[model samples]
Target chain A: MKHRVAIISVGNTEYTSLRRETRSKAELAFAAIKEALDEVRISIEDIDACVFTSVDGFEGNVRPARVLESFGQAHNVPLIDVNTGGSAGGSGVKEAVHLISAGIYELVLVYGSPTFNEVVDNQQVLNTASPPIFEKPFGLGAAHMGSLYGARYMREYNLTARELAQVAAKNHKAAVSNPFAHIRAGYTTEEVLNSPMVAWPLHLYEICPVSSGAVAMLFASEEKAKELCDTPVWVEAMSSIADTFLSGYKVYKDFENLKILAQRIYKEVGIKKPREELDVVEIFNPFAPFELLAYEALGFCEEGQGVNLMKEGATEIDGDIPCNPSGGVLCTNSGISASVTRHAEVALQLMGKAEGRQVKSPERGLAHSWGGNDGQFHTVAILSR
Target chain B: MASTEFMNKEYNMHLDFSVSLGPAYTKWMKALGEKKILANKCSKCGRHFVPAKPFCEICFEPIDEWIETDGEGIVESFTIGYAKFRNLPDPPYVIGVIRVGPSAVSMVHWIAGFPYDKPEDIPDKIQIGMKVKPVWAEERKGDLLDIRYFEPA
Candidate 1:
């Protein structure tokens, strides 16, 4: 029998561009970690273990998490650093679940702090993740990969920049009410398309900004969760899949791993008609076109109709199934931390704590994230109240 | 960070890091230095791979055969880069997703040194499935850049 896991509480730092956040990386992470413990009225000594998630490359400090031993309260304890590109946060929580489920630890805290500063050239940071032999030599940034996918999807699905723009505009508009969102200008289609073009088929507004932030989530066994919190969101099911590290090796470009992941997660969670069954969704879409791709891949709609869902406003805050109720990654992207925020967002919604963007008494929710080379890695978790 | 809150430090590393090219890449890059194409083939599934990986992703089995190939491929898709990711110096350039030989996938690389006979014909010439060959750089250092770019075959 699988051990039941519950999310007791979550804490996050304000999502803003890296340049705007000058505090030390530890300070930023400590702020969120401290808040999570306070939410559960617990002290650092209470946690049994820690799962640290973040990219050391971004911090310019190698193995910074090790340096954060005492600050993370995992000193002298096994602090497994779950590093999976942009989805580290989600991966960490999954690790926490396994730790508790395997009877290794009763309580675990998943802490992630990914920081980018002006010191490193913002443009070069993302490409460093690419395998040097294949992708890095081309010097293509993350957005270019998005462009390749967006361009092909556009050609195959008859997608338009306007359709992609709608996603950006919608997410930004929604972020207007989200205090944590980094870019919340509420741009229109024209304004987004008019925004400086990054790569052909991708404009500035269509891509995510470099937001600096941290996220901390506390997880415990079902028994401990019930005692600690009135409403502990249960982890129903979780799955992660990876495509080839080299984008060139992956033949299909339909976000194939994500689609495979969705089928498995839906089956495991006993979800049918995900659009109707899941109360709310928190998906990662660093690029706007991906939102539509994810919608189709996740079975929110048919293979090519994700754009139609957007055009019809089927994913709006008040839609039948709201998506990215906390403005999604497009609005408050902190790269690595953004992924876990999805799970946290859904947990908040299920616990009736999502103050600004709560769905109507949501009972079940799905949180999703993808990262690495060419959407190479994906994590999906189903949560229930 | 506030405008007032900051520290600037310039640090240079005297040491260089190295990665094992593995058996597959060690042979592949060695061949690149020789202006030859070496690819890995899965003995189990008969699938071929360029920029050879250690194993067949499909079969998850170790590749046992290595094959030499004609340095030719076709453009599967193309995009023009007009901006940078962070601060990486990416100027305007055309990137083509090239499907080399009958290999299972395409490699993301530059489509430069275009052998276009006319300037106005560039777009019409660089269409999908257009046959192209490697434009070997004069000097070879057993690296990917050894073959500067792909050009019309």
Candidate 2:
């Protein structure tokens, strides 16, 4: 017998524009956790376990589990801090669901926060992801690696610079209504085309902005969920996959990791033809092009027809499949916190709590995260009402 | 095999010997010394390359043949750096992605002959379609540094 788990409530600290805010990353996490419990009509004592996620290097610190010990002290709960570059949030959710189903914990609190706005050299933090022995010695950073992929993608796909511009334009338009988005205004295709290119085939506007924020989710066993909340978003299925860190596998053409994971989740949830089954999608596309490419990679569309899906307004909020209605990474990037943010938004949508960004009658949603150099690691979750 | 090992000849130091940069990249620096940029001509795919590497990303086969690029290209994109890194030029220098020919990918190199005296003197330029050519150093070495920068064509 498997124990069913549901997200009862979601909360987050308001995104800070000014870099000089007094709150630390721990404070942000604590505040968001507090708010989440308050909304769910539960206390810290109710949480049977807690999972915190953060990229310690980005905070210019390490062993954040000790700092998060305070959350455990209040409730006397077992706590674990998961750090997996940019996908820890999704990993934490996966772990929380398993813990609940395995009869270990009844309620789990998942929280993630990053103080990117206060970092001295964000590039130095990002550079550490490269292997120290071989690649890091050459000073190959994430931006350079991403550029390499973008250039290769352009050549292989014969995608024009203007088509890439469309991604930026669409994401920016979606950000207009998101109050927490780092960039709020929509940009015209001409504006995006004219913007300075940060890396070849990737313009400044197409890239995600560094943001400081935290997000928290409250998960409860199905029995506790019914007693605590009126609307509980069900976790239909969740899975994570990882590839060699420095192996430089053929991720572009051989995206079987993501495809296989999607197929598995779809099988678990009894869905076919994901484009029609999934009403809302929140993919961790830090780069705009990946979102379009993922449409094909995930079997949402036929090969080489991803651009057509976007041009037809199929991915818009009111279209066939709404994507990134929360403005996504293109609007606000808090590093490892992105995974949790993706899950939280899906939970909100399923609970009919998403304001200004909700997709109507979203019975099923897909939330995905991909990180690690060369797009090697991934986590996928299927959420439903 | 034992008899052959016992009859070993005298070992002598060789002044000129090929160095393996990594896997494939055998003849590129030699071409650079002659002010030439070479890439492998995949007999299978017909794709040209530069800073030549070992195998084709597409066909995944050894690329033994080499072809010289026409050495004419345009700036696809560029960035004006405000910070320094290893082997990169100083602050306010332009690094651009230049399209060499039919290849989809562009080579990144620095821009030369730009007025860098004052912030205002910085060209209100750097368009995507700007034509540019590689500028080799006066004394060439068969290395990536052979082309000091890409100057306006």
| DockQ per candidate | 0.49, 0.03
lDDT of 1: 0.79
Q: What does candidate 1's lDDT look like per residue over B39-73, in tens digits?
A: 77899899887877788877889997988889798
Which digits, one per residue and each the tens of the lDDT, describe model 2 over residues A200-307?
Answer: 556777777777778889888998899998989989889888765542223343355788788887888888889888999988877777777677767788766777
Q: TM-score of chain B, candidate 2?
A: 0.73
TM-score for every candidate vs. truth? 0.91, 0.74
Taking the tens digit of each residue's C-alpha lDDT, what string does model 2 give over B1-153? 223221212222223435457645537767778888776666788876654657766688888887678777776544454444434334455555566655444555666675555643443555556788788889886665677777878
- Tens digits of per-residue lDDT for model 1, A1-385: 1899999999887877765666667677788888999998988888898888876676666577877644444446667888888877778888998888887788899886654542355557677777776778686777777777776777677777788788889888888877777887887888998998777678888888878887888999988998899989999988799877876765434778888899998888778789999889999988888888889889999888988898787898888889887878887777677888888889988998887777889998989988777777899998999
lDDT score for residue A262 of model 2: 81
Top model by TM-score, which number? 1
Model 1 chain A TM-score equals 0.96
Among residues 3 or more apart in sequence or in different chains, the pairs in candidate 1 whose N, CA or C atoms overlap within 3 Å are: A20-B1, A21-B1, A22-B1, A122-B86, A123-B85, A123-B86, A123-B87, A124-B87
Error (Å) of candidate 2 at residue A248 is 3.9
- Candidate 2: segments with Cα more than 4 A from true spot: A17-22, A68-70, A115-117, A251-256, B1-153
Which whole-number lDDT from 0 to 100 does residue A304 have in model 2?
Answer: 65
